[model samples]
Target: MKIVFLIAAMMATGLIDSAVAAPKSSKQRCEIVKKKIRDIESRMRAGYSASQGIRLEQRLRELKKDRYRYCR
Candidate 1:
């Protein structure tokens, strides 16, 4: 009886943990991507090198695409 109760308690705790540990939803992902894009754009405006600017631009484009895909 005690072992059964212990197992039940462990299972209940596991379920609670899983409920609390939710992954980022699509809206959350979009928000994060937008923030990163804004930061990168600000850096680009602040006189970044050509190559670094190009990389950041590419990343920004990809993030925009992701926003369209995920946010839709």
Candidate 2:
């Protein structure tokens, strides 16, 4: 039926749209995480204590790993 064909076409288009949008959202999330890592690094360089610096560095490494795994 024409109605069935129309419904199928709409579902396919919706899937395509979602597929296109997913990468953009993922890339944006990765950039946000990178920015957070940079902020943490800057704070570390701004004379934070050794313990705090180490903790922040560890978190930065985790973020970098996530970025590599998810973004690229």
| Alpha-carbon RMSD, each predicted model | 15.7, 16.7
lDDT score for residue 59 of model 2? 74
lDDT of 1: 0.65
The TM-scores of all predictions, comma-separated, are: 0.62, 0.58
* Residue pairs with backbone atoms closer than 3 Å in model 1 (clashes): none
Which residue runs does candidate 1 get wrong by more than 4 Å? 1-23
Please give, for residues 1-72, the per-residue lDDT of candidate 2 as tens digits.
997885685345221122233435777878766666676666667776777567666877887896886678
Query: Which residue runs does candidate 2 get wrong by more than 4 Å?
Result: 1-24
Clashes per candidate (backbone, < 3 Å): 0, 0
For 6-70, candidate 1 gives per-residue lDDT tens digits of: 56853453211223443479887777667666766776778867875776678778878978977
Winner by lDDT: 1
Residue 66 of model 1: what lDDT? 74
TM-score of predicted structure 1:
0.62
